[model samples]
Target: MTPTQRHRVLALTPYARLLSVWQTLGIHTDHRCVRGPDTGMAMVRGRMGGSGNAFNLGEMTVTRASVVLEDGSLGHGWVAGRNKPQAELIALIDACARQQAWARRIDSELVEPLAEALEEERQQASQAAAATRVDFFTMVRGE
Candidate 1:
């Protein structure tokens, strides 16, 4: 899968859902940490109006982890928060996705469902907001 698609899967998926999907796939993952479930600050860079010179916005807390599967596939997961378990799980899923044997199943079962759920959640939020929306127009007064 393309990097963008993979990024979406990792970013939007909740920790519980990932665990559930792993169980549903019926494939056990026994992984050893190749790097870390380490948390650190990553410098954030930004540009003004999307065209200005890049400037350091600030440091954001990011957690990253790497895992090596028993079958020799490598995966790394990074997320924008301090949740180590989430990062580790994402890394494992990514490692599985990298292996050709597991790629299709990962995309079909894990990524697709997570994407759908994210979309549905967004839709619900939008509808709820819409329900509260008010439109005002001037009305003519008859004397």
Candidate 2:
């Protein structure tokens, strides 16, 4: 996956799911936190339609962290909400993803499953919304 797609998967993966993958992999690499799993506010923006003038929707809680592996690979993680551990795990995974040895395993074991789960969630939500959708039509009256 591209960097943006990878980050999305890492960020959206649940804390429990990430933890499970971490434990299953038994990752014991030498690494250190460069920044923090610090919580802060991020401004959310929106458009009038899909491509109109932008406006600030609101501020949301965000946590970000970074890690540096022994081989000097840097990894960063940013996620919505205040889950410190999740942010840290994401950073760790990011760093690991940089390493050639760990890249494929990370993709298969972590990224793929998470992506599938997220897609399933989107599909279910779409189906639910579609079920409630209403169609309107106009009838013409001849004079």
lDDT of each: 0.85, 0.88
Model 2 lDDT tens row, 1-143: 66567889888778898788778876689888999979999999999997999999999999999999988999988999999989888898888887889888888887888899989999999999999999889999997
lDDT of 1 by residue, 17-134 (tens): 7788777987677998998999998999999878999999999999999999998777888888899988888888888788888889888887888888889999999999999999
Model 2 misplacement above 4 A: 135-143
Model 2 alpha-carbon miss at residue 51, Å:
1.7
Using Cα atoms with residue i matched to residue i, what is each candidate's TM-score against the true structure? Answer: 0.86, 0.87
Error of 2 at 142 (Å): 16
Query: Which candidate comes out best when scored by lDDT?
Result: 2
Clashing pairs in 1: none
Worst 10 residues of 1 by lDDT: 1-10
